[model samples]
Every structure is written in C-alpha cells, then in structure tokens.
Target: MYRYTDFDAAFVAERNAQFRAQVERRIDGSLTEDEFKPLRLMNGLYLQLHAYMLRVAIPYGTLSSAQMRQLAYIAERWDKGYGHFTTRQNIQFNWPQLRDVPDMLDALAEVQMHAIQTSGNTIRNVTADHFAGAAADEIADPRPVAELIRQWSTDHPEFQFLPRKFKIAVTGSPNDRAVTKAHDIGLRMVRNDAGEPGFEVIVGGGLGRTPMIGKVVRDFLPEADLLPYLEAVVSVWNLLGRRDNKYKSRIKITVHEHGIDDIRARVEERFALLRPAFIGVDQQLFAQIKPDFAPPAFKDRDTAPFDQAYSNDPVFRSWADTNLSAHRAPGHAIAQISLKAHGATPGDATADQMRVMADLAERYGYDELRISHEQNVVLPHVHKADLPAIHAALKAAGLATANIGKISDIIACPGMDYCALATARSIPIAQEIATRFDQLKLEHEVGDLKIKISGCINACGHHHVGHIGILGLDRAGVENYQITLGGDHTETAAIGQRTGPGFSADEIVPAIERIVDTYLSERDSADEAFIDTFRRVGMTPFKTALYGESDKKQKAA
Candidate 1:
C-alpha cells in the first residue's frame, strides 16, 4: 500500500481542520443549508433521505491492515455499527451525523485515507482491478498509473468543476474486471505490435438515463504520454460538454452529439499543447511508486493442511471453490471474503467483521486487503497453507457466505433506504432474492450467475451489466420492477435487453424463480451457465418464461 508522505499528511490535516470549522459554522447557522451544500459535497458528505452519508475513498481499493482497523473504528463509533462498501470501491457511512463528519475525516487521515474528491464534480476516486498486482494474468500492476492519476487530478484547478462528475478506471489484465466500457474514461493496459506496454484509451462510456459503452479514442498511447493525453481528453470534454441540461452534461452525451472523429481531433490538438507541461515529472513519480507494490515475500510451505481441510471439510471446500481466485504466486490464492451473507445486506460489513478482516490480513495476508467492485473484500495474496485458519476466522465473523459468483452474490445500491433519488427500495429486494435462493439450495447448481439491482436509473448497482438485471421503478405511485436479460460485465461486455412488462414487488421473486427454472429446462447441460444459454438462444425464452407465450403471440398479432 502507498504510504502518505509528510506533505500528504500535512495537506490532509489542514483539510480536516478547515472542514471541522466549516461544519461548526453550518451547525451555528452562520451558513445555511443552501450555502453548505456545495461545501459538504466537496468533502464527500451528502444529505440522504434520513441522514447524512459520508463516502470515504479507498484509493484503487488498496488498504493496509491499520487502515482497515481505522475504518472499523469509524463505523463502530460514529455511524451505525456497519459500513456499506460500494460498487465504486469506496465505503459509505449511511447514518453519519452532520457534526461527526469532521471527526470521521480526521480519523481517516490517520490511516492515510480521506474523503476528498469522492463526491465532487472533480475526478472521483481512480479505480482499478481489485486483483491488480496479484492476478496471474496481469502484465503490470495498474495501481502505479492509478496513483499517478490520483496525484494529478486531485484539486486540479482546470478540472475542479467540469460539466459533471468524471470517473476513470484502469485494468492491467486482458480480462475487463474494472468494467472499462462503462466508465467516463477507461484505460486498458495492453502491448503494442512492437511488444511495448501502453494503454488502449477509451472515452465517453457511461450508464445512466442514456447508457453507452465508451469509444476507443486511441488504440495505443505510449506509457509516458498517459498523463498529458488524459489531460487533453478531459479538457476537450470540459469545453465541448453541455451545461444547459444536467441530463446531457456528461462526456458520453458530448461524444454522442459530436462524432468520435471530431472529439479525437480536438483531443489531439489539446494533447500537443499539454504535452510540454508534463515533460518528466509524472514518469519520475511513477518510478517512485513502482517499488511500493512489489510482491510480498511468499513462503515455501507444505500445503498438507489446506489439502486435508479441502478433503475433509465440505463447508471449507465449498467456500474454497466459490470464494477464491487464481494468484500469480504458486501456493497462494486470492481469498474473496463475502460481505453478502445470505439474508443480509449485500455489501454491508459489520465493524467486528472489519476488525476480523484486518487482523487476518495482518496475520496471514501480508498486511494487504482489497475491496472489490462486486461489493466484496479481498485478501489478495492469501497462502493456500493458511486457508483453513482464515476460513474459520471468516466463518466466526459472519463473513463466510461462499457465494462469490453465484445467484445469491448480488450487487445492490442503497436505493430508497438511503438514497433520496431512488424511486423504490432496492436493499430489501436484494435481501429477499438472496434468501430465496439460499432456501432453494440451487445456487451452486445454477453456476456463475450475476443478479444486479438498482432502485433508480442512476444504475449505481450496475444493473445494466448483470446476467439477470432488475431495475426498480415507480409506476403510478406503486413500486414496479423491470428485468433485463443477457447482460455481461467481463471482457465481452454487453448491456442487457429488457424482457418487456414490469412485475409488482411481490411478483418479482417468483418471476425470477420462473426465469431460472426456464434456464434449467432450456440449457443443454449443467455446463451451460445462465449467461451462456441466454446468449445462445437470445431473449425469446426468458421473455416467454417471464410473461408466457401468449405475451409474444399478442405482440405478433
């Protein structure tokens, strides 16, 4: 993990002190709610439905054990007894009081974390593949580049108030775990025909009321040109993006109105102007950041204990099968600790669970932890020899659900429960679905299914990318649910197609069950996953299953 330097520490301390004063002024009525809105949002504080929500940035999803412990302390002391890990690789304290936010920010600063740029129109937290440095398929760790972007974009005067909020994601693996296609600016680390590593830059991709996959602006940009090139892209968007209508303010909309060719031409012209400003400072910083991410000292250990546990304990074996990913180091595996315990909220981690994860990371995971975009915590470099002890610890802490990529492993937003923008409830729906599937015991049999739900079209839960995507809407003051089929979030990304007609809240679960049953009946074999079958046969079968054959016949007529 990157440690904060003296300068970084001083800067955060000053920010915290300033914000504490600002909060006191607000409480004392020196600043009205309208006056304080922009200030609070700039500091990652939002007034939600019931209370204020504080979003803290976990840069590139990397955290030290001490940082994890600090987050646990904040959750236990200030907010509710738990914190919600979000799809953006940040954590949200949904019940934070207005006065306690300054204290929370101070606590985060102690752990080299802060809430800066988390909620503002400035560059939000730069995210990457959670398995960045440890993944077997990674060509290079994307964090160094992400860290560079973080350094450059934080409070950049030029980009502080863009047309709207901007997001950037980087992925080093050929596999697109970072959802590059769905970001405002996505960078895929790839090699050129010359075998030199560089970035394939994609811009203007986003999902909201109007969802579009990002377009590739540059097929290959040299590694040294990243900072200058990114500056140019944002500059182009900042100038040409719409401000008259908030709905059309995003860079995606700009890309749609102005053709990609025109946008690319502008970006190239701006790149030439900005290229002189970033001569060598950014590359020099990259050289400094690279050493911090070197692989841990892996031990040569006997795997007898891990092998014995897998052979004997069915529970541990099931967890190992579901919650582990391949690691670059031999005898090591990436352990995904599920926050989505059956019948519980999807990404909410109790303070005690956070502490346990911190301790486990300290004890066996080389003091490193990662938060995945899938709303799970990852011990990215867990030795197989220590899997049994880690599993036992996780089980005791209620963090062992063993459904990483299964039907129960869902992604859900705060929805109406916390978000004021939501039109309907999302958390309860996610809880019901997870509980219903757990009762069926058919999750393992279903295999590699993703169910994402969003309370509104903001798509915070990434409903557009799920194998079975559910979007909750309000129809005539009643809650209704819409389903989309055949979505994917991997290297082959595709937005789901709607199944037509909406279901009542009460009918949504049974409707999902019918769809799953239909998949089972239609699949050639168990080897064919839900997504595979959906792609093979298209939406006809799932639509028929949800709305009967008569629905299609009526349309035909």
Candidate 2:
C-alpha cells in the first residue's frame, strides 16, 4: 500500500479540521442544510433518507492493516457494524450522523485516507485494475498514473463546479476488470506500433440514464503527456457540456449529442494550448511514483503443499478452484477473498473481515492487499505453495466464499435501506438473488455472468453493464424490480435489453430463476454462457414466461 507523504498527511489533516468546524456550525444552526449541502458534499458526506452517509475514499482500493483496523473502529463506534464497498473502489457508511462525520473524516485522515472526490463527482477516485501491481497480464502498473491524476484533480480550482461530476478509470491489463468503458474517461495502458507504452484514451463512457461505451479520442498518447492531455479533455467538457438540463448534463450525453469528432477536435485545440505549460509533469515523475508502489519481498518456493491440500480438503479445494489464480511469479498465487458470504449483503465486508484481509496481506502475502471493483479483496502475491495455510487462515477469519465471477458475486448499492435517493431496497434484493443462485449451484455451469443491482436510475450498481442486470424502482410505494438481459462487461460490452413488465419484490427472484432456467434449457451447449445465449435468443421467452405469452401486444397466432 502507498503510504501518505508528509504533504498528503498535512493536506488531509487540514481538510478534516475544516470539516469538523463546518459540522459544528451546521449543528449549531449557523449553517442551514441548504447552505451546508455543498460543503458536506465536498467532504464526501450526503444527507440520505434516514441519516447522513459518509463516503470514504480507498485510493485505488488499497488498504493497510492499520487502516483496516481504523475502518473497523469507525463502523463499530459510529454507524452500523458493517460498511458497503462500492464499485468505484470507495466505501460508504450509510448511517453516519451529522455530528460524527467530522470525527469520521479525522479518523480517515489518520489512515492517510479521506472522503475527497468520493461523491459529487470531481474526478471521483481514479480507479484501476484492483490487481494492478499483481496481475500476470499487466504491461505496467496503472496506479502511479491513477495517483498522479488524483493529485492533479483534487480541488482543482478550474473544475470544482462543473455541469456534472466527472469520473476517470485506468486499467493496466488487456482484460477490462475495472470496467473502464463504464467511466467518463477510460485510459487503457497500451503499447504503440513503435513499442513504447502509452494510453489508449477513451472518452464519455458511463452508466446512468444513458449508458455508453466511451469513444477513443487518442488511440495512443505517450506516457509522458497523460496529465496535460487529460486536463485538455476535462477542460473542454467542463466548458461545453450541457448545464440547461440535468438529464443532458453528463459528458456521455453531451458526447452523444455533439458527436465524438467535434469533441476530439475541441480537446486537441485545448491540448495544444496547455501541453507546453505541463512539461514539469513528465515521465520522470511517473518513474518516481513507481518505487512508491514496488512489490514486497517474497521467498521462492514450490506449489507441492497447495496441490496436496486441494487433493485432501474439499472446502479448501473448492476455494482454491474459485478464488486462487496463477501469479506472474513462481510459487505465488493470486487469492481473491470473496465478499459474497452466502446470504449476507453482497458488498458489505464486516470491519472484522477487513482486518483479517489486512493482516493476511501484512503477513503471509506481501504487506499489500487490493479491493476489487466486485467488492472483494485480493492477496495478489501469496505463495501458491502456501495456499493450504492461507485458506485455513481465511476460513478461520470467515473470509471464505467460493464464488468469483459467479451469480452469487453481485455488485449492488445501498439502496432504499440506506440511500435517501433510492426508491427501493437493493441490499436485501441482492441477498435474496445470491441465496437463490447458491441453492441452485448452477452459477459456475452458467459461467462468467455479472449480476448487478442498482436501487435507482443513477445506476450506481452498474445495472447497465451486467450480463444480467436488475434495477429496483418504487411504484406506488411498492418495490418493483426491473430486469434487463444480455448486458456484458468485456471487450465486446453491450447494454442489456429490458425483459418486460416490472416484478414485485416477492416476484423478482422467481422471474430471474425463470430467465436463467430458460437459458440453461435453451442454450446450445454448457459452454455457451448466459450472455452468449441471451445474445442469440433475445428476451422474448423470458418475457413470455414472466408475463403470459398472451400478454404480448403483437398478435399471437
């Protein structure tokens, strides 16, 4: 994990002190809720339906053991006993009190963490592949670039109040684990024809009322020109993106309306003006940041013990199958500690669980841990030979779940349960869906499906990008769940099509079962996954099964 520099420490400490005073002022009635809204949002606090929610940034989803312990303390001492990890690689406390937010911010600052840019979007948490430094397929680590953007964008005087929030994501691997296409700006690390690493910059990609895959503005931008080029992109969008209509304010919508060619032309003009002035931030600075994220020491060993454990222990065997991966280094493996614990909340990893993860990272693994966009933790460089011992520790700590890239592994938001803006509850719906899928034991057979649930149209749960996506909406105070099929999150990403009429909370799970069952029966082969099958067949049968085939407006023969 990257430790905070003295500059980083001082900045957060000052921000904490200021937010604490602001909270006091709000409590004493010196500042009305309206007056405090922007201030609170700047500190990553929001006034939800029941109480205030505080979003704390976990930069690039990395946490230290001590930091994890502090998060546990905050959860236990302040709000509820659990915290929800989000898709943005941030954590949200749904029940934070207005009075305690300052204290919470201070606690985070101690861990060199803060709530800045977590909410209200100003270049919100520059996320990357959770397995960036550890992934076997990575060309170069993306965190140094992500962190560099984080520093450049934080409280940027030019961009504090844009028409809408902005998001940026970077990925080191050819595999898009970070869902870069679902971000306002997605930067994939790539090599040019000349064989020098650079970025393939994509713009205006996001998931919301209007879901879109970003357009490639720069096919190959040299590694040295990242910041200046990024600044140009944001500057163009900030000035020209719509402000007249909130629905049309997002950069995605603007890009769609204005066309990518026009946007690219404007960005080029801006880049021309600013590129020279930003010469200070060159490849040298990136080289400096690399050492800060260097891998920890590991002893060379063999994988014999792990092979033996898998041969003997069934539970360890299952975990090894679902959670372990081949590492780039010999004797090492990547352990994906699942956040999906049977029927528990999908992304809610208990404070204790976080501590266990941190300890494992500090001990058997590399003093390093990563939180995936799927809301799971990764021990990126654990010795494969030590898999048995690591599995034992994980099981004892209650961090054993044998579902990764399976239906039980759901990406969900704190819906009506915690969010004021949400019309329906997302956590319980996710729980029910996960439990149902677990009972079926058909997730792996179904294979590589993403099930995302969002509480509302904001699309926080990435419902737009799931192979099987669900959106929860409140109709006449009754919770109604909407289903979409065939959405994907790969190189060939596609938005799901709506199945049909909405289902009541009680009817939602069964409806999903019908769809999955239909796919199972109708699929050409077991190898033809849910997405492939859905792509082939469309949602007509799923709709007919849910709403009788006769309900179809198109006259049936």
Model 1, stretches more than 4 Å misplaced?
none
Candidate 2, backbone clash total: 1
lDDT of 2 by residue, 434-490 (tens): 888888887778777789999999999999889889999989989999999888766
* TM-score per model over all chains: 0.99, 0.96
Which residue pairs of candidate 2 clash?
49-420
Output the worst ten-in-a-row residue range by lDDT, candidate 1: 485-494
Candidate 1 residue-wise lDDT at 505? 92
lDDT by residue for model 1 over 1-557, one digit each (tens)?
78787988998899889889999999999999999998888899999999999999998999999999999999989988899999999999999889899989989998899999999788999999999999999989999999989989988999989889999999999998999989999999999888999999999888878888889999999999999999999999999989899899999999999989999999999999999998799999989888888889998898899999999999999999999999999899999999889888999998999999999999999999999999999999989999999999999989888999999899999999999999988999999999999999999999999999999999998999899999999999999999988888777888889999989999999999999999999999999999999988888878888889798898799
What TM-score does prediction 1 earn? 0.99
